[model samples]
Target chain A: MALAIKELLAVLKDKKGRIVLIMPPILQLFLFGYAASFDLNDIPVAVYNQDQGADSRELVARVIGSPHFHLYADIDHEQQISSLINNKNVLIVLHLGPNFSANLAKGPGTSAQVIIDGRNSNTALLVQGYLSTIVSDFNVDWAKRNGKPPPLASLKLRAWFNSNMVSRWFIVPGIVGLLTFIITTIVTSLSVAREREAGTFDQLLVTPMRPVEILIGKSFPGVLIGSLEGSFILLMAIYWFDIPLRGSLGALYIGMFLFILSAVGIGLMISSLAVTQQQGMLGAFLFMVPAVILSGFATPIANMPQVVQWLTYADPLRYFLIILRGVFLEGDNSSILMHYYWPMAVIAIVTLSLAAWLFRHRMN
Target chain B: MSPFAKRFMRLRGLIRKESLQILRDPSSIAIAFVMPVVLLLLFGYGVSLDAKDIRLALVVEQPDAQTSSLTSAFHHSTYFKSITFHTIQPAERALVTHVVDGIVWLRSDFSARLLNHGDAPIGVFVNGVDANQARITQGYIQGVWQTWLQAYARQQGHDLAIPVRLEPRIWFNAAVRSTDFLVPGLIALIMTLTGAMLTSMVVAREWERGTMEALMVTPIRIWEITVGKLLPYFILGMGGMLLSVAMALWLFNVPLRGSFLVLSLASALYMMVALGMGLLISTVARSQFVAGQIALVATFLPAFILSGFIFEISSMPAPVQVMTHLIPARYFVAILQTVFMAGDIWPVLLTNAAALLVMMVIFLGLARHKTRKRLD
Candidate 1:
């Protein structure tokens, strides 16, 4: 208990360490909240309407009026469309031909030429979906006014759990786990390595503390700091972001406890193996980047290849993220969450035991 | 000896010393060399935004030949992996438990309603945990429904009128492969890691070990030490960049649409900005632990999240969009994406390259201003 207090004081008493703890959590929470988004608001669009007909005018008006699109400037001719995309001035350019209304009225259906900048395929695909929806809406409205048969089999898409389908609710829950892992890993990994670098490892081994006592002392500070960090972020996620906590608070805290243990174990292992703080920091980062990528935080795990999918089983964040979304979104109880809990518990045990083994081995 | 010549030799000695230290450190080598290739492979093969094989449940209340045709459309699609349930309860359970991403329900009067009024609205309940994936999955479900309707309309000899046919021109990337897009932006991230992370940690280690005082007592200048420390890592960062571009081209098969010379010049400018940020961080943080965390907080995390590489800066909030302007990786990512994916459109490339240049000047200037031959 005395040793744990000393470890906590070493971190909290340092001016820079306090800044790292308080500033980054608040700053990163806001950064991930406002900045880390996939929504395209005010996507720049260029409009080129050649036909004077009312029907073509209606379609053009519909495209421009959409909340997803913001018209930069209207162009006059065909030759200028390439320049707009090349300049990176616009993501999409809507060009209507001179015979657009005539062809739709009497002749065959004409095409609405939408030139897209496909540099980022994800953005391109999303813009295509939004644009096509607008055109389909225009088509349905046009048919009703023209005394023609309406289109067959429309869809009524209703999103469950998240009614408005905000990406932050999905991301904030995961960020709680992500930020927890980063802080705890950095704190714990730097501790043993800092002592090793300062030549205090020999002094520590000479003390009356047993190996188990030393391990618990070292891990206690990290677990405490991680839980506090996780709680702060969780409160911010609930109140500031207005994300609902649908499930029991007991289940979320249970996951948070197990997750912090797994994180501390991984950090302690890295700290024990590293000769200096630099190696510890690097190893922590090396583990973290892969863990995050494989965790399905930004991208989906199901989209990965089969061999890679098998690797995600070892990442503690993967199971923790499932628990996060399930509890917050699906209102999952402990019974349903037991499947995610045991894997993390097993990881904690395996990693902590490995850390202890590494500690004993390093004594020689 | 001339004063200039003496200064030049001392600088050369410092440079050699810095180079050897970096080469001797295994962790530096690991971070500089191994991390990039590992991240490249992960981003190349593992990280993908393209949604496929979305698990969907088909709830058909009254199974008929018409409903079978509709369910078959989902099974045939590469985008969805589907199973049929007799009632809505089982399908809803699958959705709640994450066994399925979405559910498509076919009502009892499916054919009768379609045959009479033409207003047939099918219910699609989607899991909105991942809104982007949810939208894509919902779009796929809608597509299956529309195609089946078009086929059904043909059988009944009624024209399902789609007023405007969409002619989409997907420029630059015809295959729509995300690897072609992501690998270039990843190079920006790797450069930041190699340049900023290494320089900050090494410099702060010197400060923590009291080596800076020893060097300060020598006649050699601080700027020379700064240049010496930065030069080796600049070369290493450039090497990592080259390896990344090669892997991106051969291993990932991403096309380089622009000139190689332009990419190199832009990378050099961006490397300087990263190194300067590192030096600036090391000046404030006297310990390796603080330096590492500060470098990550200042340079790397911003590069990962705020840069246009992974997330669109334009889609961000107004204040955050303004914040991206300060992040050097954003400009580099813009240039990289333009050069690799879109051809060397001089307007986009030159504009972003200029931003990197201005940022390089400011960061290097701030770093030099902060360093003095004295202990605080």
Candidate 2:
């Protein structure tokens, strides 16, 4: 046991290996902390108030008062809005019809129009929410002026698991997905490249260890290191970021185990094929970028075009994110686990098998 | 033969060798062409700002034709797919619990009030947790309801005055397909990653592998060795640029508004800046691992974040915007946008090109100074 501890310490003391294990997670934490944000501010908006009435002017004033929105211009023509939306300049267009005030004074079925650019669905959705609240508040003011009973009794809002909507709540779980890919891919790629560079790969092949054992051993460090980094990020999320982990720890670990296995498998395959460290790095990046984009990290899978959504099934990060979000945010039970388990299991098997096959073939 | 011609021929040979090395690697070829298409497709469809499948609850104080019509509109609108009509008390409970995004209340005298006053206001209560999405949803509801009112007015034998008609013409991206804008930026990002990360490690890897010591002993001039080492990566970077441009024009159908000659020249100049930055990092670090890390932090991250490739720099904090001036990708992105969208505005192109040239000269000079003959 003492000898085993010494061996572990020796491995840890190796500067390159230690950096290879430590740097990716630290870099990822810093990047994710700074870059990944959901708070939508400085939203561009256009107003087209045709009412030309006192009511229309008041409505415009109210909208401009909100800090979340920035009114770009008062467009006179409808065609201008299309250009603005297309160029991503204005996200929402408000068209207040003639007699808008007259209709509101008469009150019960009056209406106005707002056209939204749907290209960036997430931002559009949030803008929609903000508009509704503004209008609701306006309704209350209008009711008080007319001496009408308040519209209904009262309003109450309860946000579920992530009550605060802290960016960290969503982001910390996602780090598990991002870190898994970064650490596993970099470590495995570097390990294989190191062997090739040192000319020790051929010597290793002469040993009795089968290609599968060698593949497993090489991949083991990556998976272990990825999980360790993931755990560290998870702890930071809970302790430093103050995001609550409502789900069972056991379940999170199990999902992480499967995610690491699939990620390491992919890294091992790239490493086996890459002849140099540069190629290994490029190869890993080529795979990693697409994997993250398709994983629904920055966007929603359901919003994707049908064909692209179908392609996400092949991505392991997609399944892992669903499990992570579901378990951490919803505290969902085994049913959610069941939904993603088979997909993750299939990915692990396929990727590991491919890595094993490539390891043996590349050796020959 | 001139001395310059002799040096140029040697450099050309080095460039050819580098191109062959890149072509031999199938992964590099795939990354050059296939990765951009994959990114375009993914971003085109996956990144959207529209909301769908919103759950809604409706409450009516009075059971009348007018109240029912308003409730039905909420149910049938494409923006909201699932809706339930409930009593006022139950709908209030649903809104607080976030089981539904919004609640619409139809007053007891809805039809009577509308018939008497020409129009009546229906109350809508929205949860404000995601304020932006709520605003957009409100806009959608208002737009749809106004359209309904216009049609109703036409049926009533009253000619509705078209209050305002907006005529919008999108200048560059007529279809406003996000892919058209994103593909060019992706090219910038890919070049940064490949040129900087790959070349930065090359000299450093040589030092790490003990190959630089042997190469240094040869009677090669400093400029020749630096240019020769860079020649191969410059060719590879050009190949990546072409692959991305071809994908943008052919697969995505984005127009090449500017002259191809200008685009190629600008891209080639930008490659020098990128490759020189890498070589400088590699020479200074002299260790492949450290060089890779430095390249990613200094080059790749800034290119993606601060270059206005993904996020608008104008919206960033004042300090961040000031910091972005140092990132090379910012100039590259401006050049690419001007070429693709604005038909190669000469003034913009000239300023960007000069900036890139200055950066290249600085980096290349630093690289030359750092590539020492000593093994220590």
Candidate 3:
């Protein structure tokens, strides 16, 4: 315990080191929180209302009035539609037909053209949905006001866990897990390797410290630093970012502790295997890139193929992401979390034991 | 030997030495070759936002031919895998437990109301943990319902034409494959990892081993050493870039719409900036750990987040959008996407290439200044 404190103090003693450790998570949280959003707002839409009538004007009004879209262009010619979309001046172009009002009263053949730039098809799809909702809302209101039958059917849609369906609610909790994973894994994996590279490993080894004691000493700082980073991000998510935490604090901490243990164990294994700190950093980088991709931080695991989904079983971050998101979003209980918890616990044990064995074996 | 010839010979020797060292380091080889392939495969297969076969529960409050036909429509949908239930409580529970992504419930008077009038509303509950997916599922549900309505109306011999038939024409990617959007971004990301993250340790490793003093005693100028050190990694990065381009074109089937010459030119320009940034990072941080961490924070994070690769920059908050202009990968990502999907749009290519050249000059100038022969 005393030796672990000494090691922790050594890392924290330098002001630059301490600041590097503390400042990055806060900055990353602030940057990514503001930048990473798929929610469509201020999407520029071009209007080519050839109709010039009241109904067509009303449709354009509703489109421009929605908070999601901005009126970027008012076009008179058909050629402008292609030019607007091609130049990426607008995401979507809404063109009401020449006889839009005349055909609306007659019914059944009025056509409106929607041209979307599909380079970012995901954004385009969302824009289309938002526009469809607006047009359909106008349709329902117009029909009811005219004392006519409502159009085909209405969908009563409700989002269950996230009522507002905010993407940040899902992405913010993920940053907590991802930031801690990258920071702790890189920092600790470089620890023993840095000692070796600096020619201090021999001095540490010459002491009376047992291999197990040395392993414990080394692993604790990683776990401690990881927990600190995690706590900082979690606090930011709750207090600063204004994301709600619906799960119990006890369950959340337990999951975070196990996740840190697993992450530290992996870093230590890499550290022991690496002959130099450069190799250690590279090794950690290699793992981190794959780990973050496979962990479903930015993408959903359910969308992955069955074989790849099975492969994600080995990644600790996969389980950790599920645990963190479930806790944050769903308020999922300990029993439900246990299904993910035990795998992380097993990974922690196996990797830590492996790192310990490798360390002792290298010394021998 | 003339001064220029002498410099060339010395540069060749340094390149040979750096290549030998890179070959000795197994990790370097893994990162150069193996890492990109693994990342390409992982990203190509795993990182897709396109939803398919979304599991849904269909609740039928009343059993009849019309309702059965509607249920069959959802079951037959390529986008949905549906299970039928007689009540709402179990389906709602399924949605809550995440056993189903969504639930479609038909009221008891669904068929009767449709026959009596022309409209019948259905209730939908979707798990919105992933808001994007939930939104897509909602759109798919609406599409399938519309299709069913059209089919039923046609079978009933009613004129199916409606007011304002929306003809949505999707350009650039007619099929709307997510791969088309994501693969171009992968090229930028892979280059950032190899070009910046790998080379970040080269000079720092020398400094950490106390070998910089010995090297400084040699006859090599700073530019010769920097060029020689950067050339091999530049080749390695270009090779990785080609490999990613090939994989994106052949394996993932993302079309290479632009000229290969222009694509390679943009990549080379971007590589110069990345290599210069790496050199600067290694020069600033004497320790390999600090160098690597700084390189990651400076290059990789910004490449992933600030680049309009995953998230749209125009939609970001104003300050972050301004901050993105400083990141070099933002330009490369724009170049890769335009070249890959949208053909040779020279304005985008030239403008971004100019930006990359400016960044390369700044970073290389800073690196050269930092790597001066004074042993400070």
Candidate 4:
């Protein structure tokens, strides 16, 4: 054990090895914290108060008042509003009716319309929330002015899974997927590339280690490291970010283990095909981008076109995401375990087998 | 001989070398062409906003006509395909236990109240944790409610006042295909990968192989060497640009409304900036590993994420928005989108072109300074 530790320390002492182990996780953490944000804020908003009355003006004020919104322009004409949205100058347009104040004065049943650009649905949804809150507040104020008891109609929103809507809740679990992609894919790619660069890859082929053994040995460290990073991030998410881990710990780990295996397999495949480290890196990126996007992390798989949705069935990250969201948020273990376990298992076998085949072919 | 002619000759040699290198690597060439197409297909088919097969629990407090009518709406809507109608208690239990996404509470005297008031507010209890999904569900529910309201208003001998009607004409992407949005960004990403990653490593690899030292002993001037190294990548970048454009047109069918001339000019300018960035990174990073890493972080990530390709840059926090300005892809993506979808918006095109030119000059200047031969 002591000899192993000494050898490991010696390996780590190399600047390249130390940087290889440390920099990816640290840089990834930086990206997770600063770059990845789903909570839409400061979304450009354009307003056209056709009413130009007290109600219209008040509506405008309410929109501008919210921290989530930034009023870019207050246009007079509807055409200008359309042009702005089309130009991508604004994400939302607030068109107040001519009878805005009159409707408010009349009472509780009155309604106002909000037009949103749904090109980016996530931002549009947040904008809609802001719009609803403003309307609800307006309803409250109008009730107070009329000296009538606040309308009996009330909407009590009960947010399930993540009640606070802290992005960390979703992002931290997704990081398991993201980290697996970044670390396993990048590390394995670099390992294969490094061996090639040093002319040691050819030397290794004549040794006792079979192609499968070599591929496994090179990829296993990355999978272990990826899972470790995932666990560390998950811990930070729970302790620091206050994201709840509602599901069974055993189930989450199992899911994570499978996810790492598939991810590492993908990395190994890219590395085998690449002649140089740079090719490996670029090839890894080519795979990683599509994998991440199609993982249903940034967008919903169900909402994708039918063909796209069917394609997601092959994406291991898709199953992993479902498992992550299920176990972490809902604490529902049975359905996820039963449904996703087989898919993950299948992916692991398929990817690992392909990687081994590719590795042997490349070596030959 | 004129300096221009001599520089041109060196550049031509460099271009030839770069082309040969690219042709030799089948994997990189395959990735350069197929990866974008794969991404577009995946994004187009796999990522969607319309939710289906949502697990819903309908809670009917009373066994009445209004409750039945409301429950029927839930059943009828294609968005909520799988629903389990249960008592309020069971529905609430299911919600907390994560079995169902939402529970609809139907009040007592629902039918009578509806008849008297013409319309009644139905309580919709949504799990707000998945805000985007919740919002989409809420919109679908609201549409159902509006249809009911219209019917109720007509029965009451009232013409429902249509206040604000927005005829949303989604230009460029009439279908608002996410693939359309993604394809343009993919073009930017591919160019960055080829121009920055491939170019940066090539020069650094030459240095590592000791070929650079051998070349240094030749009559080739430092400027000639630098320009020569850049020339092949410039053409390679253009080739990547053509591949992306062809994919966008043939595969994704994204409309190119802007002039091809403008697209070519902007792409050429953007390629220079991308190539210049690669040269600078290669000059700074002595090793292939470091050069690749630097290129990935500085160019690839920013191009994909911060370039308004996948995420909206305008919606990002002030600091991030400011940082995005430094990413060359942001300017290029804007130019491409404008050129492709909205036709030639000259002012936007000109401003972006100017930014790319500035970035190119700065990157080339830095590359020149870094790659200058030094006497110890």
Candidate 5:
């Protein structure tokens, strides 16, 4: 316990260490949480209504009135459409034809071109969906105000967990997993490598301390730092972001402790192999980039191919992310989260034992 | 030899020594050489935003021929893989538990209400844990319903009316393949990793090992030393960039529509900025751990998050959007996507290349200013 405390204090004593341990959780949480959003509201749109009729005017009004779109500038001619999109002044152009309402009144349908700037296809797809929903709603409202029945088939949509479908609720919880993994692995990997590079490894090894004690001393600081960072983000999630914590905090911390163990184990394993601190840092970074990519933090694992989906089963971050989201948003029970937790527990055991074995083997 | 030639010879010697050290360090070689390919394979193959085969639960309160036919319409869709629940309760539970991404509920009077009221409302309860997926899944479900209605109408010899026909023509990417755009943006990310994150540690390691103090005592100019140290990493970063381009073209089959000269010029400019940022961090940090942390916090995260690579910059809040203008990767990503997909559009390329050149000059000047003979 005393040795572990000493190791922890050494990390916290330095000014740079303090900044790395304390500053990033707050900075990244605020920056990434706000910046990473797919919900595009008030998307700038340019409208061109050549129709001099009331129906076309009402359609344009409905497009502007909806919270999803904002009227940037009205275009008078067809030549202005491409220019607006090219200049990125507008994401979509609503071009109402001269015979828009005339065709609606007649049997055949009228055409309105929603020309989207597909440079960012995700944004274009979402904009198209929003425009469609608004137009269909207006069509129903117009039909009902005329005392006629609405469309033949309608969909009553309900989005569970996030009713308004806010992107922050999903993104904020994910930062908890990502931030902890980054800090823990980077810190612990540097701990022993720093000593080794400074030539203090020989001095420390000469002392009466056993290999297991040294292993615990070196590795537990990472677990402690990881949990501290985890809690910091968790607090920010609940209070700063107002994302409620529905599950038991005890369950959340237990899962986090196990995750930190696995992360620290990986770091220690890297530290054991590295001859220099630079090597340790680079190894940690190389591991982290791929771990994050495969973890499904930004994209869904379901979308990955079948072989890659099978590969995700071995990633600790993938399982922990499932637990984090499940606990935070879905209020999942302990038994349900254990389905994810046991795999992390197994990883922790396997990696820590491997590190310990490597530590003992390197001692001679 | 003239003074300038002597300086050039000294810089070459320094570059050779640094290259040897990097080669001796297995981890450095792995990071500069092997890590890029591993990351590219993972990102190109493993990560995707395209949604397919969404798991859905279908709840039919009444089992009849028409309802069975409607459910079969859903099952036949390439987009959905569905499981059947007899009632709404189990399906609702499945949605909450995430056993399925969405649930479709047909009320007991679905057919009867369609005949009597000329309409029937189907309940679509989606798990919006991932809002983008939830939104896309909602569209797919609605499309399936519309198609089934059209087919049923055709079987009955009638036409279903869709009031305003929307013609959505996607430009730049005709098929809208996510990989085409993502692979280009990823090249920027890989360059950032190698140039900024990896280069910072090499200089900081010299400082930590006390070799930097010894070098300062030698007859090397600060600019010469800076250029010498940056030269090898620049080659490594460009090599990584070339590897990414090759993988993008051959492995991912993404077309390189623009001139190769344009792509290489933009990459070189962006890489200089990345290296300069790394050297600046090393000078300030003077410790490998701190330098690594600073490089990650200052360069890597910002490049990944603020570069408009994954998230659109226009959608970010006002201050964050302004902050993105400060990041050098934003320009690189723009140049890359433009060059890869839209071909050599001079306006986009020249504008972004000009921005990258300005940032390269700024960062390199800062790094040179920071490199001093005396150790603080």
Candidate 6:
């Protein structure tokens, strides 16, 4: 415990260490919260209305009025689509053929044509969904005004857990896990490596501390610091971002403790193997980039191939992310999250034991 | 010998020494070579935004021929894999337990209401923890429901005519494969690694080891020092960029629609900008560790998050969107995506290339000024 306190204070007392600990996570939280959104707001759309008709104007007005699309330009000719899409001056073009009103009055044989810049497929798909929603609404309203039967059964759509469906609520909790992972890994990875580089490993060994005691001493600071930062970010997420803590706090901390243990295990493994601080930093990076990407933090894991899915089971971040979303959105309790808890626990056990063995082996 | 020849000879010697130093370091070689392939394979294979094979639970209160057809429609869809339940309670339980991502509830009056009233609405409950996946799932569900409704309408011998059906023409990328865009954008990210992380540590490591003072004891000028430091990493960055492009082409199957010459020019310009930023960071930081941390936070994190490499810039809040203009990777990403996805459109290429040129000049200018001051 004394060695742990000394190690923690050594990091906390250093100016660069304090800066690294305090500044990046806060910046990452704000940056990720504000910047990383999949919701396409103010999608630039050009309207090419060849039909000077009332029905076409009504639909155009609906699109322009909706918050989803911003009116970029109203072009009159056929040659403008390529320039608008190619220059990226607009994301989508809403083109109404001269026979737009005629076809609407006659039947449903393609009245309006939408030309989209499909550079980003996800954005293009979302744009299609938005336009389709508007067109379907117009069709339903037109059918009612003309005294015809409703076209089809409409869907009563409800998004559970997040009614507004803002991306910040989803991303902020994730930043908690991500920032903590980055900090703990870098700190613990550099700890023993820094000592070894300064030729103080021999001095540390000459003390009365056993290798197990030394290992626990080294990891305690990482765990304590990780938990403190994780709690602070959690509070910031709950209050500052206004994201609710829907699940029990006990479940969240248990998950956090297990996650930190596993991360420390991984870091100690890297630290023990590294003879220099550079190698430690590089090793931390090699593990970190994959952990974040494969964790399904930004993208979906289910979308990956079958072989990749098997790899995800070994990544502790994957399970922790599931538990995080479960607690924040699903209102899952500790008992409810037992399945996630055990995998992280098993990971911690395996990694911690391996790190302890590596630590003692490296002492020789 | 002329003074110009002497300066050129000195610069070449410095460049050769820096080159040898990099070649001798295994970590530098690993970072410049192995890390690129690792990052490329990971981004190409591991990441995908397209949501598919969603697990859905279908609750049918009354089993009928129409209900069977509806359940079959869910099963037939490329988007959904569905399981049938007799009631809503178990389906809701499945949703909570994450055994299912969504639940579709059809009450007992489904067939009666569909045949008689034609206005019965089905309830859809989606897990909204992942807002992106939830949104896409919602769109897919609507598509399946609409297609099914039309098929059912045609079966009843009446046409459900709609006004203004959308005929969509998806330009640039018709198949909507994300790898085409992501692989190109990843070039910017990989270049960032070569530029900021590698170069940022060069001068700092020298300073930490007291080698910079030894080098300064020679007659090497600040500009020569800057050039010698940057030239090797610039080559490494471009080599990494080329390897990434090759992988994007042969391994990932992303198209290079633009001319190779244009791609090379843009990559070279972007590499100079990256190397300049790394040089500037190393000049300011006195140690390799501090330089690495700064580069990670300033260059790399911004390049990843704010560059529109994966997330859409239009979706970001106003201030963050404005801030993206300062990141050089944003322009590189724009140029690379256009070159790979859309063919050489001079407006996009020229405008983004101009932006990179301006940033390169600014960063290189700043590094030179900082280096000269340190020498003085």
Using lDDT as the yardstick, the better of models 3 and 4 is 3
Candidate 5: where is the Cα deviation over 4 Å?
A: A146-149, A202-208, B373-376
Q: Rate the local accuracy (lDDT) of all candidates.
A: 0.88, 0.68, 0.85, 0.70, 0.84, 0.86
Clashing pairs in 5: none
TM-score of each candidate structure, all chains considered together = 0.98, 0.76, 0.96, 0.85, 0.96, 0.97
Clashes of each: 0, 47, 0, 8, 0, 0
> Candidate 5's residue-wise lDDT over A143-246, tens digit each?
67656565566789889888889888888899999999998998798887778777887787888988788889998789888888788888889998888678
Which has the better TM-score: candidate 2, or candidate 6? 6
Interface RMSD of each: 1.4, 7.5, 1.6, 4.8, 1.6, 1.5
Screening candidate 3 with a backbone cut-off below 3 angstroms (N, C-alpha, C), the clashing residue pairs are: none
What CAPRI class is candidate 3? medium
**Superposition error at A329 for model 2 (Å):** 3.0
- In terms of lDDT, model 3 sits at 0.85
- Candidates 1 and 5 compared by TM-score, better number: 1
lDDT per residue for candidate 3 within B205-322, as digits (tens), equals: 8887878767777999877888889999999999999999989989999998889999999999999899999988888887676777788788988899889888888788888889
As for TM-score, the candidate ahead, 2 or 5, is: 5
- What value does the TM-score of chain B take for model 1? 0.97
Q: What value does the lDDT take at residue A275 in candidate 4?
A: 74
Ranking by lDDT: 1, 6, 3, 5, 4, 2
Instruction: Identify the candidate with maximal TM-score.
Output: 1
DockQ of each: 0.77, 0.16, 0.70, 0.33, 0.69, 0.74
Candidate 3 on A181-249: residue-level lDDT in tens?
A: 987897679778877777787788789988788888888788888998899899989998788788777
- RMSD score of candidate 2 (Å): 6.4
Q: How accurate is candidate 2 locally (lDDT)?
A: 0.68
Candidate 5 chain A weakest ten by summed lDDT: A142-151
Local accuracy of candidate 5 as per-residue lDDT tens digits, B68-131: 8789999999889999998998888888777899999999998787666577898999998898
